[model samples]
Target: MLHPALLDRLCKTYDGRKILDDISVSLAPGSINALLGPNGAGKTTLIGCLLGLLVPDSGAVRIWGENADKLSPETRCRIGFVPQTMTGLTWFRVQELKDYLSAFRNQPDGAEDRRWADWAALDPKARISTLSGGERQRLAIVLALRFSPDLIILDEPVASLDPMARHDFIALLSETVQRRETTALISSHIISDLERICDRFLVMKKGRLIGDLSAEVFAGEIRRLAIWPDTALGLEVLADLPDGSVWVRGWRPELDARNLPVLAGDMEAYFLALTR
Candidate 1:
């Protein structure tokens, strides 16, 4: 069967600079994939291309075995998205907006997953303008998750939420993914927020994907070796290791060389290896 989402040799450029360079990947069904990169690394551009908001110069983005740019309205509604930031629509009351969204969500032949307002705990009469940043984010999340979309794209979803709210959001996200077998792609700089939930990672650099691997494989490949050299070799002790390993500062030259890789270290270290 064809993949649910595919970006095949996608390329996009703006002005004189390239925004995406030969991007190609297929997102697995029911998988939580994290997309990571530094600023200006073309993450947003790639997402735009996927959503058919921006056309790639060459190649294609396919959703449900059909071209994304020309997806039928019914197919399009099956996808959900939460952008990095939202604005305007501040005049609508919380329940007013939910009612408006619900009208569009329940098409004649569409799947129904309703009552997301309750999932988000948004006050019915609250004005969008009066809601806090976290509350706004919560509302956005509910809108995206309400349909139990076949595929969900979240860009920096937890950046504005508090610690407890972040946890709760992840729990909600996980529950949705598990219950409905949803495919989710989340782009975020908050590694800690994504590390536990993501089953796969996509690392980008200079408008190109540098690493794409399952979370388990990534953990095995990028290891933190704590070294203690008996002799004064300085940094030369790690001169023969692979390229991705980082030189942690716990090394002691005079003491015994304790060269052991820590289990389940921070995902940030792996990201650093890809970017640097």
Candidate 2:
């Protein structure tokens, strides 16, 4: 089966520094994937390569089985992207911008765009310059989903949103993806938000793909165990375990395994454990 997106041994370098090391991954159709990494981990660079915005020094990028670099206009229209920053069109009204983008597509659904704008609580008549950061982010999302693309890539999409707005955005995203069976790759620093919707996690560190696990496996396998001095299992014993568990900071001798306290081992914890 063809993947919605695939990167094979992708490598990219800039100014004599590697921005993306040898990386390989494929996005499953209709899957909502969370791309997690710290700053300079090359999440944005990978996205750029996948979208054909940046040429990888080596390897290949394929979208729906077609070479990403040579995607036909029809294939390109099947993809939607919400960038971290929305710039250079601040003078246009929201509706005007929508119309401009719609002009490029073979089919433009103005009603669908308006529906998304309403869901985002955006005023169509409002100028882009007048929108707040969160509002601009909302507009970006609306524009990206307006055409019902098969794949959507979002970068720090909810960075400027409030907690409630973030929740709503996640819900909207989840619904849209499920309804359209659209594949989504979301890169964000907000782990909890991603945990709420993403079924798969792709962890990167220092420009390398360090981990890839389904949410279930991540929660079950990657965990923090509070070991106490009283327990027969010492740090050395844990070190000898077959699973290759490494000891992280904050060792408390007072807590024991009998009353073992297990941290939720959510995405944030797993991300920190992998990166740090």
Candidate 3:
């Protein structure tokens, strides 16, 4: 059986303000999970805490039943993390930089360069300063995956990549993770891309977990209703929708309605009931 990547009631704060509040979720081995939220929704903070870059005020983080902080260097070797920012590297050629970082993974003598080059899809002879933003981002991913870690955490990894590059990178990442049976936790606002790659999703609002749903649920359950209120009755009907799901859109209404498919219990009238 695959092990569970655990985060048990984790909480983090900065300057007396809570960033993560009792956040708890798990990623199963060989699964891809998407972390999503609006700006300032604590996605970055959560990543920092998970990577041991920031200590939480309370709670524990573990992977495959091993506490992250308690893990020794060797155990820590099984984790890979890539931040949003491209790690600045204007000093070395692409090949030189890959060779340099690959050493830390202890790959066999000549194999390091080969593996890095293959994974990055970049010419080792290319200079870092001359590489485009997409190439640099690819190198960063190569550095993260160089060790063949059991778990990969990426923050907005495709943000800088061009459309084609982003598509290619995602395909490569998906294949690599599945082939290696590696668990991945990806945080990005690109819902469309995530919908394509993620098996599960975590939604945050106001620094707290608001929704936890699988990819299917996200697509099937949540709905955007393009409503036209042509009459007073329609206005009253629109007002009847459940709280939080109701909103006025000029001459129409665009609502996020759930508990769909069934459409039971006075679908149109139920909306009027709420609006009234």
Candidate 4:
């Protein structure tokens, strides 16, 4: 299991604008965590730090009980990473490429090797150059699974795949996560895909951690609340709610309020008051 603690990243522009300011988060073991953020939110930078591809200006990345920077080659070998960028040239053949990768990592011996190959349905000799984008993605995925790593990090792994391939990939990932007892951190802009397998999601905006919501919490806490402001002063009154869960949709008077569904009125009212 990989217990990750990202302390903070302080990135500053030449103009003195802070790009990433005091970001921090902890990732638990055996959990599927989705990092959701808009562009320029520093998701890529954070991933780079996790993968040891980039050093943070100011931060600590810890894995399990030790610092990530001090991880040994043996520890590093137990991690599988699939970057958003393509790994190799399209000219390479699939089977040939996978075989080359297999030689680098020590896969399980005996029947396990056959089982892993069969699991991905990858023929050892197929030309990667002939595969489609989805096929390439699948091949990359299988390559990542080759060593049975304890932790897998995927960045937009399904973006290039078709709907069916995407579905199959998620299913395969779900099965692997349970069977192998592996933890995963997948970053994707697709909300629906993240909603499917992610136990929790970390929301980021402008390089800041904006929200941390579990799937169940999101389903229960996020709601559409409608309100009609009686006066200009009414907006000010509603701004004092407790939970700070409100966002203004628009400014209008005499809202019909017919479309409003039955909700936890207390929470909705609380949100309205707080974010007002």
CA lDDT of each prediction against the hidden true structure: 0.78, 0.83, 0.69, 0.64
Q: What is the C-alpha RMSD of each candidate to the true structure, in Å?
A: 5.9, 5.2, 8.1, 7.3
lDDT of 3: 0.69
TM-score of each: 0.84, 0.86, 0.76, 0.74
For lDDT, the strongest prediction is 2
Rank all candidate structures by their lDDT, best first, as comma-separated numbers. 2, 1, 3, 4
Model 4: residue 168 alpha-carbon error in angstroms: 1.2
Query: In candidate 3, what are the lDDT values of residues 1-276, reduced to their tens digit?
Result: 636467779898888888899999888888899887778889998887777777788898876666766766766677888878775777898768766776666563345335555656887788888888778888888777777788899999989888887786788778877887889999875667776778887877657876576766434443323343335523322232443333222222232233222222322232233223
In the range 211-243, model 2's lDDT, one tens digit per residue, is 888877655444465442234544322211224
- Model 3, position 3, has a per-residue lDDT of 62
Which portions of model 1 miss their true places by more than 4 Å? 107-119, 226-264
lDDT digits (tens) for residues 53-129 of candidate 4: 76667777766655666777777878888777565666667666766676777754445455546655655567777
Lowest summed lDDT across 10 adjacent residues in model 4 is found at: 233-242
**Candidate 2 collision pairs:** none
> After superposing candidate 4, which stretches have Cα over 4 Å from the reference?
1-17, 89-92, 108-123, 228-276
Q: After superposition, how far is residue 214 of candidate 1 from its true place, in Å?
A: 0.3
